[model samples]
Target: MSIVISNPPYNMKWQHPFFAQSQSRFDLGLPPENNANFAFVLSALDHSEKATFILPNAVLYTSNKDEFIVKKNLVDKNYLEAVISLPGNMFESTSIPTCILVFNKRKSHSYTQVIDLKGKETKEIRDQRGQYGKTNTNRVYKKELNVLSNDVIKEVLSVIESRKNEVGFTKSVSINDIKEQEYDLNPGKYIDTESVDNIHRPYEDIIKDLNRIIESKNGVKITINEKMAKDLEIYDLMQDFKQSKELNKNMNEMLKAVNPNLKIKKEDIAALSRNKEMKFEVKNFERVPEMIALFISMWKQFVMTLNNEENRLLVELRDALLPDLISGDIDVSQNEYDAKEDK
Candidate 1:
């Protein structure tokens, strides 16, 4: 045989019978069983004087032990001549994409040619006569080439003869650069598909979008003390009312203790009055005001986030009733409610 052409048995890398045999020759272990396609490739590379093998696209750029050894063996000796990457759906019965790899032991040319034969249909007429076979399906069948298009094959042959570098679509990469990419033989990685252009977005528009996203983000804590202002005012008012009531109660008590017959008039009393146990007097008025003010200040300090037990209880009650209040679910008209409702 001028050229030995063979399609070996399909076996995965890990489980294949040839893998054990091949590893000993190449001194590299088999690729993972998930992909044994490379094992066949290695076997072909080792055995054939010159070879053309169809392998699944994975064998081109694998970095595993089998792949590393295969690449080192091929490129170190400059065995690989041409690698043609084909398109998907080339194999209709199966979905695996294939590539045509041409290898040679002797150096025919300085540069390697890569041809892309993807995305093209190949057709062959079964019969020249407009007659059907014995099976009664009366149409002449068209058989397509399993591998390369005529145009692609022609280009490949031409490139092999030319031995010159072609850029953009086809690349004749040097052995040194292939070594730099860690022996990765992927054609798409080498080919630059992007077109150059100056594209810029407006700064104002970008800022506006960023601000919108920031505002849309939920659960961000804001340091705004809205309730603090209103609460402080209410606390001051309550403090004044409490102090006035205590003063009025004390004055009434003191009057009664000083003169038993002297009746304290309701009109003379302050607007707020409370019957407290402590004796009320004008002498204690200043002290009462200071104590009430201090209590109000302490209450202000306590008005922060309700993280304590009492504060937690208050918050729970508020939250529990809030939904019902907002949804108008509870009937406030029911007057049977008493102190027991607190329980």
Candidate 2:
């Protein structure tokens, strides 16, 4: 045959590719054991002067050991005439991205033409996942699908015929240029795209935003969260502190009444309670030191726990801001740092 054209079953496995390694059809190399895509290409080319096949885009640049060797050999032999990349969702059964491979035994050009047709489609219907196709009226794929409009088809034919370079669409790449790309044939790999740079804001502004995240929410009044219930542990601790202090006061008065020169050491209390309804009496003045010792130890630990929580918040704030500041992403220059310190 002089010309052969086909769209074979994509990515299908074949046992013959593994066993028929000696066949001339695989003169380049055997296709990967997992898929018969390249096997179909080679077989079609064996019987004809020119063969064109629709295959999944993976054949263009897949790095599987066996398949890559075959691809490299194909490029080296200059069997490839042109590769045209088609958009994904072209098939009803699978949305696998596909491409057209045109191979010729008798060639006119040494360079291979690569065309990308991703953004050419003007009308496209998206599939609705997780919906029953028959039952759901809203399921788009059941009624319509993406297709190549006549204009897009004409555009592709023109690009192929012209074999001309169009920015972001097509290019005629030489074997040496393809080698520089390390045997990659994906059309997008050859397209040049615009780079977007990040805009860095003032460090203080970013810090304020980060602080809001760290805080989780705006602060509220203490009375809103405070419990009205009397049996709470905090209430008991407050009462114990108060009663002990009052008892100590009464005991001191009693001891001083016996002798004006007598005095005792006082334990300092940072947090105190005043309950006017409670009456004071000395049940056992001797036990007052032990009572103060126990309550003061508990109170000190409670204060320490609150302090530790504050320290943790400080650590977290530093962690959140430090990396961005150091990397110059937030731009906390020496001047900015000094200004923040003044603030």
Candidate 3:
């Protein structure tokens, strides 16, 4: 039997005309409009007796009805041999998480083996080399190249050859079990990863905690209001500092010191004064009072910007939190009840 291996585009969208003409190709079901991930798989299965295709992680457990049905048929027919969920950032071009779907046309076991290799051993490679062969870009390189590690290869081979369940890594699930899971071929669903904490909490209890968080948000609003008031007072003081007699005298002296041939007018200073926000456009002005006024204006602007951002964030927080509170979606008492039950 010939073996065919290909890494098709992750989520290529098929044109309507192609799907219209090639009806025989996708006998399982039509691939979803937004994604062509499964279409590539079907194309490979049609041409080859044994094929291994690299696909996006979404193809494993997509909730789409058409895709789900196709996946269900594949598992029910016992054509799907194994699914390996590889670690994220495995390719240099894209960080879309990927999986290997192994298919066999010949008679196979009733169970489909799934191996979750996510967060396994990772080797960092230089994605882009800089001048003098140094690593250039700020992007952290944690992706696996086309090559798989010897250890990972060995583990995969061991699981396939032995067909035994390995704790937290590999599992051979019956077709009935896969059907029970709504045909979710995601290996993580069946295999238990050692590092993952699968804590399933009730939604009601979580909503109650959100309610408590909403109540605490009131205190945050009060603190933000107080800070805003203080910021306004500081702004007023800085404005007064700009209009001081010392600053006006320094401005006049600096104007006199400049070339007399250069046109100087009171209206120029007046125009600059009209702007509430001060700018350091005054050239050749080294007077102590003028410099102090410039510094004060710049400092006031910075403080105002900081205060505005703080106020904006507070408003956004209130906007975000208040809706869930007012809607009564979060029940704080439920959390209290759950806590008591635990006791």
Candidate 4:
């Protein structure tokens, strides 16, 4: 059996004469406008009975029209065997996350094994001298790194060999399911990482945790509200300053109309308002309205960032807890029975 394995350079533009003249291999679709990830895969498939390619994460779920067409074709033809989402920083040259695509031409099932090994790596701190150490110091520069464990490898192989679903780690997905998901091969979309924890705590405890989360979210809301109130007060001050400026302009026009010889200059008004040392301050104060507006814009953006962070936390909590709650893994029956007994 001929097997081809490669880690093709990602996002390379294919403009070579060979690529330009290649027509038969691009039956699925032409290499995308800017990416040749699938083009390399197709070339390998042409020469070998089975091919394994390490590709960037985008290749699995890129929405580019031509890329998606090729992906859909591969799924439809049952050419795709497995897609494994590896952890980040797996390569020294790039920090972009990667995945492995396994293809086979032999007779097999229509389903593909999708594995999510994102967090399977064990994190260790290594010193500048390449020795594993615990404490970080100036001379002993420390770096947190991930390494694939033997058990993770064995588990991945077992799932691929058995074609069984391993909850959050691996799953066998039918071609129809792939099509339903718009040909998205991202393993995280199908696997729920929280489910793998298998935490079977009491529902009361879960509810308490949720209440704390809600309280934290509410605190964020209160901070946002306070910022908004301050913003409104600033806006009102700006409006008042604008009205005062308008009145000063009208008064100047009236003075000019009343006495054609008399000049009602802004500098004259500043000279009358304060001392020589405060002249610069008075001049710069004219720009206070503009400064206020700019400050308000920046403050609003800061508030928006805070709000987005709060929303992100809420989304993460929901993703982590909802599955366990719905699956009945966090038992609620005990709490319900206790309540009834107390009543």
Assess every candidate by TM-score.
0.44, 0.52, 0.51, 0.54
- For candidate 4, lDDT tens digit of each residue in 11-98? 6666634655456677767765456788898888777888999987778877679888888888888999899988754653333457
The global C-alpha lDDT for each of the candidates, from Candidate 1 onward, is 0.46, 0.57, 0.54, 0.57
lDDT per residue as tens, model 2, 14-43? 676444768888888888654677888888
Model 3: weakest 10-residue lDDT segment is 215-224
Query: What lDDT does candidate 2 reach at residue 163?
Result: 77
lDDT of 3: 0.54
Which is superior by lDDT, 1 or 4? Answer: 4
lDDT per residue as tens, model 1, 1-343: 2353554433232565653654554544455554555566666656666777776555665545756676666776777777777654344222234577777777665455666554344543333223332344555444333445678667778876665455445677667767777776666546544453322223233223222222211111112133443443443433443353344343334333323343212211112223322211222221233223323332222222111212222233344444554666544443232323222
- What candidate 1 gets wrong by more than 4 Å, as runs, is 6-24, 27-35, 119-148, 192-343
Q: How many residue pairs clash in each candidate?
A: 3, 0, 1, 0
TM-score of 1: 0.44
> Which tens-of-lDDT digit does each residue in 1-343 have in candidate 3?
6788989755555554454536765777777755577778777777888889987666776776878877877887788888997764466543335689989878456777899785464565655422221334444333234446888889897887677897878998888888888787778678854553333323233333333222221111111132343444443433432343233233223323222222111111111222244333333221222223324323333233323322333343334434444666533433221222112
Sort by lDDT, top down from the best:
4, 2, 3, 1
Number of the top lDDT candidate: 4
Best by TM-score: 4
What candidate 3 gets wrong by more than 4 Å, as runs, is 17-22, 127-147, 192-343
| Residue 42 in candidate 2, Cα distance off native in Å | 0.5
